[model samples]
Target chain A: MAVKDTRAEDEQLNRFWYRYKKHTLSRSIVLQLMVCAVTIGIILTLYPQPTIDAWIVIGLVTAIAIVSTIVATSIAMRPVKDLSSALVHISGEPTDLTPPNINDSYYSRNKLRPLLKQIYAIASANITDAEAPKSSIALPNISGQLNHTSTGIVMMNQSKQIIFANSAAPISIDSNGVRSLDLIFDVDQPIMEWLSERGEHDIHAEKSWRRIPNKLAGESERRIFDIHVSYDRGSEAETIITMLDRTGEYQPEDDDLDFIAFAAHELRGPITVIRGYLDTLNDELIGVYDGDQEELFQRLIISANRLSGYVNNILNASRFDRRHLKIHLAEQQLADIYDVIADDMRMRAEAQQRLLSVSFPPNLPTIAADSNSMSEVLGNLIDNAIKYSNDGGSIEVSATVNGDFVEVAVTDYGIGMPPNVIANLFHKFYRSHRSRETVAGTGIGLYITKAIVESTGGKISVKSVEGHGSTFTVSLPIYATVADKLTKEQANNTSLIQHSSSGWIKNHGAFRG
Target chain B: MPIKNILIVEDDRFIGEMYVRSLNKAGYSVDWMVDGNDGLIAARNKPYDLMLLDVMLPERRGGEILQILRGGAQDLIPGTKVVVLTNFDQTEQARKDMEQYADGYLIKAEITPKKLLAFIEKLAASS
Candidate 1:
């Protein structure tokens, strides 16, 4: 819609220029001719009357005036004729505006072709619009060239006021209104400026908008859109944005899902038989075997565990993509949850020669969070930190309580991220270029973490430098029920600060109750 | 340990038969059932040293069967050890269920027949 509107505006500006140029040139020519005529008339009036020589000079002047008038009239009418035909074409009645038998070779081809194409498209588009007032025309819209399409389209002014919005946009905004776009769309201020400046330069931004806060009556809605923006050529002032509903696009291909399900179903049998064989071998219940056979059995066990992990990751990602991921919430201490996840991941961290450390202050304020979800979030972050960090690098987890909010920071001394990637750190399937080479990441961990954190009334943010390291801070609202335990003064003064000295342990102690 | 009766409870028939063959080749008598209900009935009808149970089974679930076996009816068998074999690993629910019943839980893809036999042998000896 914006694209079409912008194109129309462009045409109007073009017509204004066309008319302005013709008028200015004609006016200047007429002024020059008038001045010449006045001078000639003055000369004739001043001279003695009725001599033959004087009559000859007068005839010569009159002949010159007649030739100049014809030239001026023809020159002026040429553009006027072009304008008339252009206007007629624009108003739904198409006519051949390109003059017949005009020698195109006379015009400079290189300089004029682009301008001519622009003029032609603009003129033709308007003609189609006027011709078919009710019929759909092939003109660019927000999506670029919409022909009977239903995509949510929105246009906002500088004031953030939604001026021209489509019905789909309103439906998507739902009860939350345009205010929701402001909350979720986290493009940089400079990017917005760039969009405005470039006008129609395509931008690839991954924007995640929460499904409208309030639901439509009785519609069990579990849908969200991840819009990918690209530029479409239209006008210079307004941008052209294209959105792809990623939820619809990212659902695993049916073949993959079926394969996984079938494999899992088939795996049960062989595994059962394997377990039985292992039991027989260990018991010497079966025929005696050598140490090599026992070692092979051990290898089989390890392979199986690894395969299980892969299958689980695939299944989890599928659930998350489907938006069927759910978290069970309960009142819990941040430090305690950290301890559990840390312990669970400690062996893995040690096996990789990386250090994991955690810290939290005593008497720290409690937050209402689901322990399982929190564990998953922490595990993912810690795992990523371990993966990206150097072999002997150190990782730290700390918590600080700020009134109603508690901030949990996970800092890793690793190969940090670039500014480009730090901005899109939480986007799904978004991986840093550097990390892509060495690390095997699904790129959905941080996205899942962000979703889990936000769904529980908590927010996660990242701070990083390319070479130094990265710190991910999660801010969660302190549990409301526990607020009454502290007086106004104590509540204001209560703050928890913890620092980890080494791997998975805080010098300030594990957690403050 | 040389010659004994074993019961295999699994939803997939192919897997159940494979277990039966492997255990039978090991010189131990083996009984197989496709569902938890039939497995439980088999356990009641005959005495068995160990039972290999699949976690997700039709008619009755492995967890339900574990509860019944661990309940007052355990006097009927005197001493029966069950090991839960399942594929859903790393999940909190699966972990919780593993901790709840069975001597030990083994993910289906992770354990081999020989290693499984070792674990069962250990369980039998310890009992």
Candidate 2:
């Protein structure tokens, strides 16, 4: 978008110059002719009578008037003429808009000086805006910081030329400011290309850390620099591209996720086999168990199964805490998810003597979500509602079509939380004072839920009123790949519950406490 | 039709034996290979119904082996449904690469033999 805006501005500047040039030439001719006509009329009025000698006097007067008019027009137009030539100079080498050598004449100093300065300011401002939208990032006194700091600092103009270079900048990149920074820094490869292509730079939006390989003096040893790029739209530095050497500290080879995964994978194999064998025993596929033995084995198997769930949650929570959870996104129809989850949740709600109400508006947009994560998120919220709610309290799960987002809210009319408790609900290992005593929880569910929600480019929020139930809303972005053309007719029916796949749509079942 | 056969490519002997026993009990003809190289060779030779590949192996990494199986580095068993099994905390890089080719992904310690059998049975029934 920025690049296209720049090209448009450049074309506009060029067209303005073309029109200005033609208008000046035509205006000059008209002015000269007017001057000659007025001078000739003045001579005729002064003579009053016509004779051969008088006619000669008139001819001389007209000749003198034409000569003086031509000279005066040239003199007056000279400054504008110089300015046009200067504009052409500035346009050709626009990236570096420094006014160069010019003829010092009577009109050059006073007229052209301020005008040239004003035009330069406007062109620079336009180009900077083209580089990046007026950045909301607050950058402090960069020049002062650069002088005191040891790290290399180089600020680039719109064309990627080093406009301001501290002494440390050249030493770090091992290149003088004589060449385009691309030769020394590798922003043109991945960082700049991704920004131009995708309009973002961060690996994640929270941190602006990007690794750009620094081309050392020789290709023998590879050196890397971790840089955080910030665009300063207003200040002298149009784009502050800060480089910090990360060759010593950042090592991809030493990442420990593989090791942890390996250990976890190793632990699962034994656990799976043991659980399978236990299931077989419990099923009586083995020799028939005696009454007392069967009871003991059942108890053992139940505990083991519960242990497995705990282990899985703990392992998953470790990743979520570190923000290392991996999720695969696809365009998934919400109807399929609702049908699957609601079927099981209905049974659970009925067992607890509570009512579970589910409603889905028709033509619901598909969300860009990992089905597994979606299942886990929905499962967590529903399970929490079931556990936290009082007996016979109703739980409502509804899917509403929000603009550019699909909101799946689970509102339970159970034991609602106070504001102080609700504030710490999403924090890891934060158990409410009321729920901690009554409910059994690890407090990792909401933390994992929040992480999964954010990674999908969405948000999860909660609203609660003390003595009433709490509402937990998970908002997911509509998958861009899917064609979800919401029609005017569909928009009229805010509750299109009767329209979507009816397997789980608008199901209302109440159970007696 | 012939029996549903599967190749279990895992380095851990304990895990390899456990999967073999469960797969056998589930009525699958299972071939267990302890090394990634041997697993790759076995997969190339036979049309196994499914392949359980572990990331870390003695001869080759599980990712590299899957790459060849999926026609990335080399195409060996393009039609074979592979399950990339790893134990560590999830990594975005591995999942993004392996999930493209694999039929399923599992963390072994987190999944029991019955769950593994359930996956195999589902894959077998679908195929």
Candidate 3:
């Protein structure tokens, strides 16, 4: 029975040597061949002489062969132990890496003893560290490189070690080091389970996460992240954890409940006044025969129209919020639109005893824009200027073409905006805190104007002082083409030709045309 | 001057019909045109003692028609006493900026039909 057991053991050892020989030590194969060659030479050099010295030399050759064979076997098996312990280190599992009968084997005193000792030491060191907090793991240094650069690697493992983090990660994680993955995201069930499970998770499926705290510009806020889980292919128990920061600025959704409430509030007063006027007009309490009564009806109509303008502005602002505002691009003469708006507002300006003036550099290029929108924009600006101007102040509308861009400025010499109000003037429903007492405004005109201008790929900026006036400058790309000018000229010629033909017909007695 | 006939030019059908109904009850012959173009055609085709003109018309806006008349585009409608009706009273100040255009300016929203009838009667008596 002992002989059969020894045979089975010998078979296992032979298989193990063949398997790990290439991975562990193919270099020892050449060493064994050289040792065998020297042994054979020593045996051949000693003839079959019946002498004590010859016998002694033969004994030395046999001992050398045995020692060389033992050295080769130990060299081949050392790395297998190391590989097994590495797997155990990653999994947090106790590994049985001791070679059977290794201490009783002939190669126990070989150089491979030290390698086996190191692998055992490494595996045993992790036994007590099983419950070590992941946060205490060695963290990488990642500071001062956030805004301009990003490292593309992300890592998480079952060994509780993570690596290759950029500057934003430490700040994002909100801890000194990684905590238990479960504890970090325990609020999100799917994410916690996904991190524990050693497998890749689809970001769409595992998107829920615990909110991480962040401070931006002295304000505290929360950041969200999407964790992607992956496992090391070489070992099933090992895992990789990666976090992606999905945080961005807050853009309020249109149709937000608060925004709708704001809209309703804005329209309520104007609509009430309009409805009241209509009721009075229907009642006709003023008798039919007075000349002054005719004038009163006219004033009612004017007020109704003014109220209509406010409603239209609110609707436009809502459209802007929805991102549904579309620009109708057309080749339009900027100077002509400016002239019409300035001319339209001139009377109102004068009514307040304020001055309104417009100037255009001669032969300024025509801009491609929606004519109605341009007129509306200019009209609102000029009207606001007139409304906000002091009794004796002036409002100037000026435009000039400069290097492929046209800059139009509306300057009002009136009570201007403070820095805080000016900063938020383009925000929806933001009324100038200063102008609230002095002016009657819906606070939507400038917001709508900015939206319209930006929708056309133009930019608007303002400069203002508290007690002086504000200057709003709009810079639009000039889109003047030779073809457009030619077409315009052709249109003018056609109209002129038509006029001359009509004149000729009238003079030539063609039915008195 | 007998106040038997009156011409009304208004773009809005509802307002024009209202004017016609109100003027006919006041014992004046009323003819209504829906726009400036038709008004010009009707004015040349007949002699009316008074013409009520709306300054903002749908087709061929009232300002264009006025420009044609004041610039000698038509002779038969010459010196027609025109009373301008507009939704925007500020437009009176605007119309004044135009030379030799509207004879008089009236706001539609502020006036009642009865009041408009009296004003027309007075103008007719003066003429």
Candidate 4:
């Protein structure tokens, strides 16, 4: 529904029909005209009728000719309709999206089949060629210019054969000129596994490095190098992969991150213990809570959940800093995600005397995302909205289709931020100087949220005015997969922390404390 | 089937106790060991329905224990289900080792007592 009708599609379809028709002229109309002449000639030769009778026969034949022309025109253009439908499936999706097979009729098998292939090839090429002008990025100095710097430059063809490799490169081939990265880099994890994941990425886009212990480095230490990729995806041309040694960049941070990760997990132990005992105490085995004790229990539950959230944020921050944040992307339901985040935060919002609401079009498309990461993304946004807003200030979370993306917006009319604060809201550990004193936060929430949104091929931005409100919006590419239910357990969430999607489990027996 | 008995190998008393209580509440016989050697001894002596093994232990890492149970000549508790509990040290070697031997790898900070019980129950049922 986000894709409104466009003149470009109509024009392209018309162009396709023009190329499909064999002759320049309207063949169907010409054939109908020929048939009319033939019928008239036969009538005249068979019956030399008087003027009135001849006129009646001629008029009837003329009408028949018109009807025949209409029918023939439709049949001729039927292939056009079929081809247009095929292109529709191809237009908005990747080249691998399987277009409908052309019907195996005589007209289709020969005519439409060849045309469909040609059109598909053209469309896919056009998508890549749109980037061809941008692919003019000068290959980072391949020879003498790059040799001076420690950065390793390696250009590889579609088969991943090394076309060029500097001596200083992080990876190298043998005397036999072996091309596979597996053969060259003595790494615990395959370097090609990292390289092969980003073939369709647009020009100049860089994927994160796969930090693995390099046996080749001779130190048994983890070697880090980003794989800068440049390739014309439509062609079998070489993908230029440049390895910039970032091991030095994050080497020192590792010690701090290790401590941070362990400290966060250590904190998580107490929180979990506290929460577990609370849940057990509230269970049927323990005496039911009195009227006032019920509210007290709720407050305890909220605080425990908050502590867990803070610890998880620290863990996420360290994971991100250490480049251990693994986002497993799949098609995910936005509606389900919105529902889960809202439901989990509802009690917390009520505790703070604020309203939390979620409204999305019932038919919002599934987005290409990491489900758990996306939950974190939305949760962080809503959390900030609730945290910054004044008591009783309503928070609204809504999503709408925007072009090829689903635009999710979280609006809150709380204590709004100034221009300066809004600018640095996503900076690592960037708490507003004012909020730093008043609010309790790890300050890594927005940073992690932004990283997640961007890595999933989405964008996050916020607009706010001081003392009014803020609207944080995230735009995610719509995935074509079906909606899936939010289960409490996930393959990725096989960890010590409860996944945000699992917050709904609180409603299950003895789940909520 | 009768109650499934579980053995938990963890160093932290708080987390170990939490898992123990939660698993007990779920109607399973649970045992906890704070040291790697003692846990391994218990694992080899008794046929547990499932084992929640932590990677960082006193004498031996959980990965080593799993490797012994899975590949050693003794093949102690070969049929027992083992899920590795990881902490901050998710180095490539540690990750690959766990993946090589353990049935599942979960982070201690990412999982809770209730969630662990759910996973234990799932493994118990499947076995």
- Most accurate candidate by lDDT: 4
All candidates' lDDT scores? 0.57, 0.62, 0.56, 0.66
Ranking by lDDT: 4, 2, 1, 3
TM-score of each: 0.48, 0.47, 0.37, 0.54
DockQ list for all candidates: 0.16, 0.21, 0.03, 0.09
Q: Model 1 in CAPRI terms: which quality?
A: incorrect
Write the residue-wise lDDT of candidate 1 on A1-513 in tens digits: 999887766654235535665676677667757766787678777874658887787668766776776677666565445545444554454344543122354223324434444556765665665333232343343224232244545544344344444443323355656432321232122224444554323433223332221222122432234443333333221222323333344333323553564466556455455544554455562355565776555555434433434444444454554444544344467777776445346755666788887778877877866565676677778777888899899999888987678898989988888888887777656688878888987666787688778766788899988788899998887877544543342333222212111001111222211
| lDDT of the structure predicted as candidate 4 | 0.66
Identify the leading candidate in terms of TM-score.
4
Over A1-513, each residue of candidate 3 has an lDDT whose tens digit, in order, gives 999777755633234434566544555655766776786676667754447876686677766766766676775565564454444444343434434233545436554455556655654555433323133222321122222232222444445455344443433343676543322321123534554553454222223232322222123343434555554433322343344554452223223423643564445344433533454454565566376666555555545545554654665566554344545444456875564344336645665688888888888886755554666677777777777778889889898777777899999988887787776677545577666776888667887888788766677889999779889888776766433653575453221111110011111111001
Model 1: residues >4 Å from true position, as ranges?
Answer: A1-152, A156-313, A477-513, B1-34, B39-55, B59-127
Ranking by TM-score: 4, 1, 2, 3
For every candidate structure, what is the RMSD over all alpha carbons to the true structure, in angstroms? 16.6, 21.3, 22.8, 27.8
By DockQ, who's the top model here?
2
Per-prediction interface RMSD in Å: 12.3, 10.6, 15.4, 7.5
Model 1, position B114: C-alpha lDDT score: 49
| lDDT, candidate 1, at B100 | 43
Candidate 4 TM-score restricted to chain A: 0.47
